[model samples]
Target: MGQTSTSLCCIFICFMLAQTVFQVESANILFFFGVSSYSHRLPAWPLVTGLAEKGHNVTFLSPFKAKNPHPKVVDYAPRKFSEWAESWDEMNMFDMRKKGDMYKQWLILPYFGIAMCEKLYSDEEFINWVKSSTYDLVFIDALFNECGYGMAHIFGAKVIQFDTTTVFPWYSSAFGSPDETNWIPDMAYVFGANEVTFQNRLINALIPVGWDLFRSWIYFPQLEEITRTGLSTTDLPTFQDIEKNVSMIFLNTYYSEEFARALPPNMVSIGGIAYVEKRTPLPKDLAAFLEKGNGFIYVSFGTVADLQKMDASTQQAIIGALQSFPELQFVWKLRNDSLLKEFPNGNVYISNWMPQQDILSHPKIKAFITHSGLIGIQESIYNAVPLISFPIFAEQDYNAERVHRNEYGIRLEITTVNQAELEDAISKVVNDSKYDPDFKFTQYSTNDA
Candidate 1:
């Protein structure tokens, strides 16, 4: 009896040791890079959440909050911008329309450089946080121009580049394109005006050269000194190099919705990563309001584009247009309460914050009026809703162009939009059978691929 009892005790001890070994082997540390923008954070959220759920530790290095905070997350503190610097609050899509191409190229180009430097150099807390944490892998947004890639290099960890934009030359190379083409891959051919014109090609070529010059001559020299790091302006790697060295490239896009292109082994299309929530419940007030409507057209310029920045007349015009379409309810995400009050009709429901994903997934939502942020575009594709894209800045113009070319939506220039144009665009999207058919096909292909 004593011998048998001793054998059982030994077996139990061995089982506990094996369990501990398995737990340690399964554990890993993942570092994420996110800039201040809401769009940048949105895509990373799913991966971070998934990793944590799988019992891995995630350290998110960003100036924004993680959407779904997890116990495993080690969030770095937010950084402040300089006094002369424009806060994210100062940025709006209208700036692109009001400023024109020349101003945008000059002012905005440098702005990104400065913003990157500020986030990396001024934020000592972030630098310290990164140095202290040891990560098995790093996932960075492509726009984290200075910090993400740089940190990954500093830590000597495997990196993954996450693109929130449509195909640019750098991205194209990952998919085995030997050279950058001016062609918009998916719909450019369908649009008939696709392919790079000589002038367009020339301009595209010059922009990168000019950008390199700007970075080398101005941005990098200043940044190197501030950070006390050896990173020179010329030290910046091309998108190709970043893609090559990284573990993989995950685009916030899908194959069906995008121009089908051949990709490298390291590049993966995991579009609609943001829509993983099976059916997140909407806020009670917003859900109740949505239920009351026959069907709704969801209008939002995403998180960055402030409705208040739009001229009051433009705002009124939008309200009037929505009111005219009484049969179709309008759920406008207007940030300012005054603007919401201006449209008091029960047909139009205003919310400072809405469950965007829930509303998009709702069967009652017929159309999406968006600013063409990658996240918003992906959500529209996932929900299979027709779009009216009014792109403001950054990659939005690129996203909007693709949507129009794909025949899934109409692209309205925000600077020139009016009631008639807005109404016409909405009518075309809602009335056109081809739009929905193409959209559904695109969604299917994206998911299947």
Candidate 2:
């Protein structure tokens, strides 16, 4: 009996020691997203919230504050670069699309990024905080928001970069992934999946290569200088060095929607990171509005689009399109409430904002009119809502092409779209069952391949 008791005590102590050795401690994570829009914030939100819930301390640093706050997450919002963003000129962008001046747009992005980094680095409080803080991991935005690389160098932490969209051409080069422009067109090319031909293939290849060279020669140098100046040290490594050693990259794309392409092991697709199975209740007024008509078609140009700044003709085209579908109620996500008076149709309900996912989840929602933003497209697919996609800028046209290719919706070129064209697109999506997104086929989750 004595021997058995002693053996049992020894076994218990061994078990305790094993537990001590195997236990995983919570980490300090810094999510640095400088000079980004609200759309950039949503895709990585689940990651932030997930880490926080798992007992890690998460610092979410961005100009945009959290729409929904989590207990374990700290939202750090510094000065917003509203002036820089506003200067981009919404009208100029529309004009550029009309004139096919897409190449010129890429030239301005680096300047914006450098300016944003300078703004962040200028804040004395932000600098002091960075100096004092110790992070185990740094998650940085892969856009012009590369300034966060300096912080990762300081903390000596593993870096994780996230792209809010599918891997761009620059991403392919930087991460050493196969771009294969012969078969796969650049995101800026604005062509269908199968439209990559011999003539435009050279153009596709050169665009990314040129952009990469511009970044390597001009953008990175300026970024390196500013980062060093901000940190007050020349001892830091170059952005390229830090970027090459990054631990992982999370892309906001799914395989089922994409053409077959080779990917590096470190690049992960966390497409439905923001997806939630449960739906939230809509506001009283919004709920009442949805209940009134046979069904509503949801329209939103996305977070960054300044529809108010759009020319009067385009605004009238949109308004007229909604009026054409008088039988079907229209729920438009327009920011200017006063502009509601411009819509003569009583069936049109305009609000600055509404719970988009909840509205999409509603049984009465017949179709979605979108800017073909990836998040909106994913959510629309998840809810089996057909789309009327009008792509504006960035990779939206690419996304719109996919929507059209998959028979998920109709893609309208916003530059050439008139009231009649808009009306026809809306009419087809609302009336035709062929446009309905195949939820089972397209729906992706964290577990998706």
Candidate 3:
């Protein structure tokens, strides 16, 4: 009896030791996700929740809250944040697309970053809250959201960037990630920068330098000024110094969807983190409509393009082409539903929202007609659906150009596509058989770490 009791006590002591070690390994993490869009936040949800599941205390600061949240995660947003964010969302993409400026990508985004800085820094209570909190790691959503670095400096924590798109030249330079300018193109460059022409090569080489100068001379300096004001901490470091101290970068892309780039040990690719949920059953009405036609095609410009406010000429062109193709069913994600009455087509179906994964993965889906956003392209690749892309603005042009180069899809000229051009492009993409999947990124990325 004495021997048995001693053995049981030893087992209990071992269990207690294991539990203590587990608690020690857990951390207090801060996610500084401000007024980023739904698409940007969606992919990060899995990462946030997954960390929480592992017993880490995650504090998420966002302008919006998750519809459902993990038990261990604490959420915060200023009362006025939602209202301010809604106004930015209401900005017209149609007007932005009408203007043709090559420098728009490089210059316009930094201007927006300055605005986001003002919005976040202006809230004195929020600043005080951050100052009081403790953290082991700080996460910043990259792109124009670089202002997040300031929060990291305040907490004296390790910084990691959750990049919405693949890495950019500025990020590559700042973090010392691999940049093979000879084959791998600049993210902003349209149609894949292969360095085929002397002019193109020169442009690619100078693009990074121009943006770096702009950041050094204009953007980062403004950010640093905002971060320093009213802070009682006697020793204040420049934003550039803080930027260099980032410990890791978790991009929303992986080897299957994007080309395998030479990333450093600190750079980890965690693609499709948001796509953890399986595709649920489609609505009966949508299923019935899809079944009624011999074949159907899917169309969307991602979530941001308020199709209701889209340019009238562009709408007319798309409508005209759909009307011409009565033989095939069309599933269009045009939030402006009145168009069904205005230009009625027997074979067309329009909805304000779509379950993209289900529709793309469906056997009935023949091809996709899209504006070629990065997420849209990734969806198409995930389902192996060919693309008919009209890349209008920002990274859309770059994505469309990539589809064109890779031969997985065809591109329609953004500024010049009329009814005939739209029809021709759609038909060509439907019939083309030249897409090479070996070059495409299709695997489900599993790097959650």
Candidate 4:
């Protein structure tokens, strides 16, 4: 009996030891965020940093290097492709808004994607490093980085797609997810969840199919050519095959905010990865400013919107609206400080950069006037702050529609943002109890740390 008990104890000890070993085991992960914008990189930071913290060695490749990077995370900023970001800076979104032709916008994507691939391929040092290293898994930006699929193939690593935005319309066929355009609106459209008209549905259906054809017939061939040349081998899987075989997709979407849809088993929603719930102490002057005049509302058009480009009428309208709300202070984020002279009101606090997270979490923040970028929308929702969306470009309109449909805020067209409309939106969002902060949505965020 004593010998039998000893053997059982020994077996239990061995089992626990094996479990500990398995828990601590780490793998080499390659995270490639092809986009250089801070908006794209911000969502991926928590994941990369978390991996490094868990003892996994992460190799991060992007044009923008992270600040206060982890010791285990190696960053490589390829200089050649960094210039492509300059075009984004020069992209006049105001023009796109005026033209109202989405096809023109779509045409630019193929060129941008192809150019990015060619630039990355031409970097011999980066190519050599890719050849020399071994990666257990490769995480690629799902937006404009199809070349990363080939890189994963080179290292014989499992591929994971990191979508900074919600799933694209064409991602249905690629990722084996449902399109369900009958109710689910396209990201570019401002149709509400319940406002899916026949015309909206027809356009939504046709848009995804057309986009797929463009990608498959035009974009994929050029991308594959550059990818093959980069890898120095033509004998590799096509983009279609690689995309279909992706091990998993880390989608930046949540059901609490998005329409419910069936997703493939391999797809995971890790939305709100960038949202910080804990409130940080605000600076003294900023804190004092917010406490005055029946609390303040924060206004920001995000990183890309050039407020200086706004026509004089629109600019004056915005200024007039801000002045009209004298009882309530306004904190505006403008990139160009020259506009500061125009906003010379005691109630309006204009700054080039504001601590967005801290501002949202402040007790005195009554509402957020935003460009309706998904990141900003998510941050505002998690903080339980109501919004007044002045959508600029891209999916901002779509996000604003959701805000409007959900009764969390209102959406206004930037092109026609007059003082009357702006004042009405502010008044509705501030005084309406239905638009007040609902803390329940905070539970929807998948941020563990």
Instruction: For candidate 2, report its TM-score.
Output: 0.91
Give the per-residue lDDT of model 4 (tens digit) for 42-83.
Answer: 778889888999889899988777765778789988777676
- TM-score for each candidate, following the candidate numbering: 0.83, 0.91, 0.87, 0.90
Could you give candidate 2's per-residue lDDT for residues 4-109 as a string of tens digits?
9999999999999987795669999999887677778888988898899988999998776788888789998865443445544453566676677765665666
lDDT, residue 53, candidate 1: 78
lDDT of each: 0.67, 0.81, 0.75, 0.80
For model 2, the stretches where C-alpha displacement exceeds 4 angstroms are 1-22, 80-92, 193-195, 342-345, 437-440, 444-449
Estimate the Cα RMSD of every predicted model relative to the unseen true structure.
4.4, 3.4, 3.5, 3.9
Given candidate 3, what's the lDDT at residue 378? 71
Which regions of candidate 4 are displaced past 4 Å?
1-23, 192-195, 437-449
Which 10 residues in a row give candidate 1 its minimum summed lDDT?
Answer: 183-192
Error of 1 at 381 (Å): 1.3
Candidate scoring better on lDDT of 2 and 3: 2
- Model 2 residue 399 CA deviation in Å: 0.9
Better of 1 and 4 by TM-score: 4
For candidate 4, what is the TM-score? Answer: 0.90
Candidate 2, residue 359: the lDDT equals 88
Where does candidate 4 clash, by residue pair?
A: none
lDDT of 4: 0.80
Q: In candidate 1, what are the lDDT values of residues 1-449, reduced to their tens digit? A: 99999999999999998877753444445545434465677766778778877777777755565555777777654545332233667765575566665236334644565566655565665566656766767876665354455556556678877766544443433345433445442211112345557766666655444545665567655544544453333455543354467777677777776665666676677887777678878888778887887888999987778878887677767777786787888888877656555555667777777778888889988899998887888888877988999877666766787788888788887876788888988898888787887688777765553
Tens-place lDDT digits, model 3, residues 1-449 = 99999999999999999887732488889887764666666778888888999889998877777666677899887766666777766666556666756446456777777877777667788777868888889898887677877777777789988887787778667889876665666777743444468777677777888878888888888988877774555466777788888888888775655665888898888776565468788899999988888888898877766666667787788878888878888888977677677545567778878888789878888789887777777767767788888766666776777677667788886556689988877787676556534323442333221
- Model 4: weakest 10-residue lDDT segment is 440-449
